[model samples]
Structure formats: C-alpha cells, structure tokens
Target: MHRTDGTRSLAGLLALWGATRLVLLLAVFKVYVFPGPDVTSDVLVIYQGWYEVLRTGTFPLDDVTWQYPPAAALPILSPALLSFLDYAHAFFVLALVADLAVLALLLGTGTRPGRTVRGARVWVAGVPLLGPTVYARYDVMVTAVAVAALIAGTRRPRLMGALAGFGALLKVWPALLLIGAVRRRAWAAAAVTAGVLTTLFALAMPGAFAFLTFQRDRGTEVESLGALVFHVARHFGWDGQVLLNYGSVEFLGPYVDAVSTGALALTGIAFGWLLLWRMTATRFLPHTLADAAFVAVLMFTTTSRVISPQYMVWLVGLAAVCLCFRRTGMRVPAALVLSASCVTMLEFPLWFSHVVASDPLGVTLLFVRNGLLVLATLVAARRLWRTTVARPRPGTPRGSAGEREGASHADADPQGLPDAADPPGLPDADPRGGPLSGARRGLTSRASRGAG
Candidate 1:
C-alpha cells in the first residue's frame, strides 16, 4: 500500500536498489561488458605490459608502445601477481575491482558531512560496470584513488592529501587539486603527502624518477573538451595542431600555416597570465577550489585537439565532486553532465561505426549531441548568474572568523539554498574561524551543503 505523503520505506528503496544490482550482475555474465579486442583501445596496452613486467621482475620501459607513468603501472602490475591466471582474465578481474572501488569511494563519503550527490552514488556504481570504457582503459584504478582523495579531503585533509599524492604518482591530474589547499593548513597535508609519495617511488623503484623526464616527451595528442570540436572541424577542412597555453583556449584553427604557430604562442601566454592572476588573486577554500578545477579542466578540454571518450569520465567525476560540496546550484548541472555522458559514451563506440557507415544518420547524431551540450552550457551559466547570497539573520552573532570570499546561500534564512538572488559562484562564506563560532554551530560537514 502507498502512503499519502509518498515517501517509501527504507526496506522498499533498498529492495529496489538490490534488484537493480542483481540485474546488473547477471547482465555482465549474460552479456560481455568487457569484450575481447575488436572493442578495446590502446589504453589497455599498459595493463598488458604490467603482466610482462611481473613475470620478468622489472619495470617495463614505455617505449611508445607503453606510455603511462610508473604510478599507473601499479594497477597493471597487480594482475601480474596472478601468474597462473590467464592475463585477459586477470585484466577483467582488476576492472571489476575498479568498478567496486568507485562504489567504495562513494560509500566512503556516507559518514562525511556534505549533501550526497543525490543519486550519483547509484549511477556511478552501476553504469561504469555496464559500459565499454570500463574494459577499454585501466584508468579506473587511479581515478578511483583520486576520487577517494577528493572526498576524504574535507574530513581529513592529511588523509585526503596522501591519497591524492599517491594518485598523482599514478596520474598527473590529481596533483592539480593540491592547488585547492593553497597556503593554508591543507598545504601542510599536501607537503607531507608529496614527501611520502616521493619516498615510496625512490625506495621501491629508482626508475620511476626517470619516468617523469620521459613523460615530458610523451605529451597528449588528444585531450580536453575542445578536442571534440577540433576533430569535427578537421573532419571538414580545418588544420594545425591544437595545444594548451596557460590552461585556457588559444585557437589556431582559422589559420592553416606558419602564422598559426605564432597565434598559438600568443594564445598560450594570454591564457597563462590569466591563470596566474586567478590563482594569485582567489582565496583558497573547498568550494572555490572544487568549482575552479571543474571549470579549468573544461578549459583544457575545450582547447585540446584530441578528445578520447574516456576523457569525459574525468570531467564527469570532477563535476560529481562539485555537486558533493555545499553548492546546490551546481547539482543540476552535475546531474545533466552525468546523464549525457552515459548516453554519449555508451553510444559512441557501439553506434559510431554504424552511424559512420550510414553517413547521414551519423551526421544527424553528431548535430543533436553537440547542439545539446552547447544549449546545456548556456542554461547552466544562466542559473549560475541568478544565485545571490542570502543575508545573515538579525540576531546571528558576529563569528570569530572573517567571512570567506565567496558568500554562501546558506545564511540564517530558512530558504536554505542558492538562488537567482544568491551569489553566482561557490561562496567563500567560510571564515577561517567559522567552525568555532556559535553562529554556525549546527552546520554539519563544512563541505556537504544539504541539497534540496
């Protein structure tokens, strides 16, 4: 029987959660989520090398054939320990664990103080398990570690920093979040983490140090959000290599010759100067750091020439991080980003070939997909513009700490969320001493803003 108010029992919801889980588990064996070659990409080559390295008792050199950093090598090396098992089967098992690790990070945040990413934990845990990208790359291992670090950062800065440091050793992106800590106490956490991570690399394998020098030569050909547009333009008539200059857009497309390089050079310096100014000017706080990083990564994506589908996972993951923070305005955008990603990524490989073969329909799909993203971005920006910060209640006492730069919507008012009248971005509402002040006493996890 249904209740008048429409809230379901915990038993009912959990039963539903379990039924979905059962269907997914059965589908994996019933259908091949991780199909052998023909469907996989070169990202797995690292996993292949790890199996070889374990058998030989040495770290394998990434001579073009294998090009990931040594930290990422650990996950691949994991399968090597299973010497008796078939390497393909080992790769599958590790992927399954990686899927589970995403869940672990999501669940790990349950005890945490912020608003949950609504249904994010459910979709993240479920969808990646069923998708082709799960099998295409061994990225999940490092990605999961990085996510765990982001979530844990609010509760335990040191633990969060350590997890991030270890993940940075595995993948370069995790190091970027350290910028969030700024010169505050969180910086201490980052420093200790860097020390621990360096020690690990130094003690276990001297070779890992040399891997950094080698990585500079092996730069990204395709990455960033802009890669999609660049590829489409090239598919038409555009030419020239796409590059990043100071973490922003510096276009070279309109020109196809030597003039393009100079244009790119100018673009890079302008963007670099802007990034430096923003970093120097903005005060560090969880909300600001999270929002800036999400946007910054998009800047990278918008300007890159090569955008692999798997790269979308990184953005979606970071967007999820933004949502978990106290910012309710970002949750809806995060939701759309997640939903669209599932559709785009799942359809890309499976339907891309058929669409290409069909030609006309593929063109239609491209139009609809790209057009939707452009429209969605506009809508998100509009919502962000209207969110004005709320005022403190009349009797609310003056806090011991100074107010943070970005004002939060969560004032003494009962409305309890960011809106058109509220501030446009993440509020630096947190004063350095806000926690100790009785005015903000009942506020739960400083990061987990209660999402409506």
Candidate 2:
C-alpha cells in the first residue's frame, strides 16, 4: 500500500482504539463507585487519601503507604487542583490526558525522518489491549515522560535526561534510559536528572526519604515472575500462602523470605548484566538506546519482587518507542511484549480469582504471559548483542575500518543496524580490494615493481 494510504489507515485504527479505550474506561468508572472482584482497586482510593494529606499541608507519609519517590508527589497531588471533580474522576482524567499525550508523541515520532509508523501502531494497539487499567493508573503519566525522553535522546540529549530524571522521581525505571546514551550524552542527562531529583528532595526533605524506608521491607509480590517459582512449588506441597502485604499480594510462610531474597539477588544479577552489556558493546545504532532501555526495564520488571500489571505499561511504552526507529530490529520483540501485556490484563481483574486460587487456568495464563516476556527479553538482548558486538562479515565493506565509519552514517532500518552494503550514491568497491579500489591497485603495482 501507498505510504499515505497506510498512514490514513493507521490513523483510523488509532481513532477507533482511542474511542474503545474511552468506552472501556467509562464502564470501569461506573463500576468504581461499587468495586467488586471484576474491578481491581482504583487509583482513586490511594489518591484520595493522599490528596487529603496534601491539603493538610503535609506529605501523605502518615496516612498512606506511599512507596514512590518524592517526585511522584507532583502527579499524586495534581488531582487536588481540580477540586470540582471527585478524586477518582480527576485522577482518571489525568491518566487519560497522559495516555493521549503518549499517543501524540508516538505519532509525532513516527512522522520524523528515519522513523516508521510501527511505533505508532504499537502505541495505538498496546494501550487499550491492557484494557481500562491503562487509564486507571498513574503509570501512563510516567510512560508519557518515558516516550518523550526516548524520542528526544538522539537529537536532544539534555532534554531527554531531564525528562528521564523527572520520570525517575515519578517511578524509578525511567532513569534506565540514560544507560544507552554515549558518555557525553549520558553525563548531560545524568546531571540534569540529578539536579531535578536533588531539587525535589530539597523541597520535600525528610518526607522524600520516607519511601526509601517503606520500600526496604517489601516482600515478593505474588504477581511477580519470581513468585511463579513459589506458585509452582505450592503444587509440590509447599506451604506458602498468598496474602496482602505492603499494599500488594505477597507470598508468606516457610522459605518465603528466602525466596524473596533470591529474587532480589536475581535483580542484582540482571543489573550487572546490563552494566556489562553497556561497557562491552561497541556498535551504537540510532535505536540502540531505546533497545537498551527496553531490555533494562524488562530485566528489572521480570526479576523484581513485584511485577504489577501497571508495570507492563512501562515495557509497552519503551517497546513502542523502539519500534519507531527503523534500525531497532525489535519488531517481533515489540509484538511479543504487547501480546504479554494483553495476557496480563486477562490474568488480573478477569481471572485473578483463578490466579489467587492457583487454579489451572490462572497458572496457564501466568505461564504464558511470563513466558512471552522471557522470550521477548531474550530476543531483544540477542538482537542487541548481534548488532553491537558481532563482527561484520569478512567480505562485507563494513568489515573495513574506513567503511565502518561510512556504514555508521548510513540509514538504519527497524532492525537497529545499518545496511551492510554501501549507501545510496556511494559506489560499491570490489570485494577483492580493501576499502578503496584505487588504494588496492596502487599497492598491487608497488608489490609488482618490487617483485620485478
């Protein structure tokens, strides 16, 4: 199909998807007044209590278990400014606005030179696929920030860092975006991030550190991938029980502590791997930062003690940004991530009872969802390794040191690597010759004279 036609079609699809998301949210809002098993806990419950605390001119430290960073206070307290609307309605509207903003950014990035509409496609489809939870949580706001930071990374490093730092305060994972940046860009971004974080902490002071204390004792949340080991262990007569702890479903009982510790250790290992990848990898494509960010988030999410459904939004948002870059080579990985998101919704708020009961269906859903995430993580990591670490083919022009510089300037595709062949308008050199045929011929003539 023509590109214009394809763009028009995608626009239509996005419109329909947005409308459906609105409908689903309205339906969810209607039921929020009288929540049941079908309706998961609303963000309003937490926000309302926190809003009241903010109104009293104090942090929500005493009233609510606010485990988020001090920067999170911005979004948490924002709904209070709209006092005309109930807290639930106001937070819902905020989430919707954030969601729309993310969509706009994705669409804008898609239109940029060297980007594709695939990123927009992922955004259009993945958000609603997660159902009303997309608008029912504040993660969408952080996601919007993440999308902005990633899209701005190549052209506006400082801006990207500032946004990422702001996002880090809202939720910690957004800071991971800086790891993919080059030394100078990473430094600029890190400095901006540190400034933002420092300013927020200075304002909040003692209250800002409250979240740190609160988070220190968290248990392994039942929905986390690591918890699956315990879930399966239950079948083998393990006596662990799932219960609400620290505002989440957690496994409690014999060896539960040990299991949670193991999960934390695994997370450390994941971070180490990311650090090693960053230090060792050489080739840096345009989409490399986004791809690395996705992998980092995936590693953190999958290995964490808590894999809240809302966390899936983080992965989906980054994956969409990754897909926008023509050279990211993450199309299938992005699809897998989106598919995992849909299954997350199914497992929660829908078949949660099954999951809670450790029933066959729930186990199967968790297995599938977690498995898809694992596969996406592995695939993305492999692609990243190949693009960054693998040597160019022996006969390929990119194998030459001089050609490597030229190849770096060539247009990259969605696979996150430049084409192996010479770029358009450039002559293809004979493979038997080194980088330049003239240089090879001159060397040959000298050798012939020496032989004579």
* Per-model TM against the reference: 0.65, 0.85
> Per-residue lDDT tens digits of candidate 1, residues 64-125?
33444566667766766676866655665666566566655554443243445343454354
Per-residue error for 12 in candidate 1, Å, reads 7.1
Determine the C-alpha RMSD for candidate 1 after optimal superposition of all C-alphas.
Answer: 8.2
lDDT assessment of candidate 1: 0.49
Model 2: lDDT to the true structure: 0.74
Per-residue lDDT over 199-241 for candidate 2, one digit per residue giving the tens place of the 0 to 100 score: 7675755576677777878888878887788888889998878
Off by over 4 Å in 1: 1-37, 41-46, 54-58, 81-84, 108-114, 117-119, 182-185, 199-289, 354-452
TM-score of model 1 vs. true structure? 0.65
Q: What is the C-alpha lDDT of each candidate?
A: 0.49, 0.74
| Residue-level lDDT for 307 in candidate 1 | 39
